[model samples]
Target: MCATLVGGMDRLKREYINAAKANGVELKVFTGKENCISEKMGQTELVIVFTNKVSHAARKEVMHYAKSRNIPVRLVHNCGVSSLRQNLATN
Candidate 1:
């Protein structure tokens, strides 16, 4: 499953989701509000926060929830390798 932070919905059109779809993957967009985001999280396997604008509240809540569920979080800007590098740099 896939859910993006606010402003990441455009990725669905920017070719990433399309590639996933071409590879026969199911991508889901989180359209609900704050409380709804948690509910949506339950149905998803991972949360990809593409936008830096994600609120502090959402980040803390989602990170905690995802951690408890063993769900991985990814921040993909364009490619997977660069994302990994960025994550590693942050670490």
Candidate 2:
């Protein structure tokens, strides 16, 4: 599975990455304004996006990329560790 932290969302990106790794999962954090999401997803089996700003475009881009790749994606709205567990469990 592939995981990328969407946006800077620095507030929680670090913790998210930490938790993901703790579960033996590797992840990439996207801190740029507009990143090459599609390309990033290419190397990943699944794209786990964590963000507070859930815009229509963001939602579309994420869903489109994951769906197109036939890779399952789980959205983490908060930095709560529980969400990470649930997300990783599916993988």
Candidate 3:
């Protein structure tokens, strides 16, 4: 499955990708600092957002984009690798 992750610690980006890979998911992560976040989240099967780390505008955009496309969004406040795996496993 393909997943897009927004927020989470920038230092753990590689770990996040590895964790997703271990779960058999292809994950694209955005730290919320970049421009055009919603546009970059292309064709994902799932949208995982770290609520505590992401900016309000970025979160809003992600929600809108995912809703419009009928894609599932998972909100994780903790933003840990373990939490990511858990969310990915759930669906």
Candidate 4:
């Protein structure tokens, strides 16, 4: 599955990417909210947002775009590798 990960620290982003790789999931991570554009949304099957790390406007925009395109989105408060793993594992 291809997923777009929005908002996370550099270290956490790397960890999430590594974890996703290990799980056979392709992940495209965007550290800044600005990178969560509509163009990128089209390439992903899922959208996971780190709620605490991103701006409200950016989050809203992402949610709106994802919903419009009928893509699934998961929002997590923590931006850790474990959290990402658990979320992906369940869905």
Q: Which candidate is the best by TM-score?
A: 3
Q: What is the lDDT of residue 33 in candidate 1?
A: 31
Where does candidate 1 stray beyond 4 Å?
1-17, 31-34, 77-91
lDDT by residue (tens digit), candidate 3, 9-81: 9999999999999989999999988788988988999999999999999999999999999999988899899
In candidate 4, stretches whose alpha carbon ends up further than 4 angstroms from where it belongs are none
lDDT of 2 by residue, 64-86 (tens): 87787687777767646567667
**Clash count list over all predictions:** 0, 1, 0, 0
lDDT (Cα, 0-100) at 17 in candidate 1: 51
Tell me model 2's lDDT, rounded to 2 decimals.
0.66
How many Å off is the CA of 42 in candidate 3? 1.1
Reference-based TM-score of each model: 0.55, 0.70, 0.97, 0.89
Task: For candidate 3, list the clashing residue pairs, or say none.
Answer: none
The per-residue C-alpha lDDT of model 2 at residue 70 equals 81
The residue pairs that clash in candidate 4, if any, are: none
- Model 4, 5-59: lDDT tens per residue? 8878877777889999988899988765575466665578889998988878778
Residue 17 of candidate 2: its Cα lDDT? 80
Give model 2's TM-score versus the native structure. Answer: 0.70
lDDT of 2 at 9: 59
RMSD of each: 5.8, 2.7, 0.6, 1.4
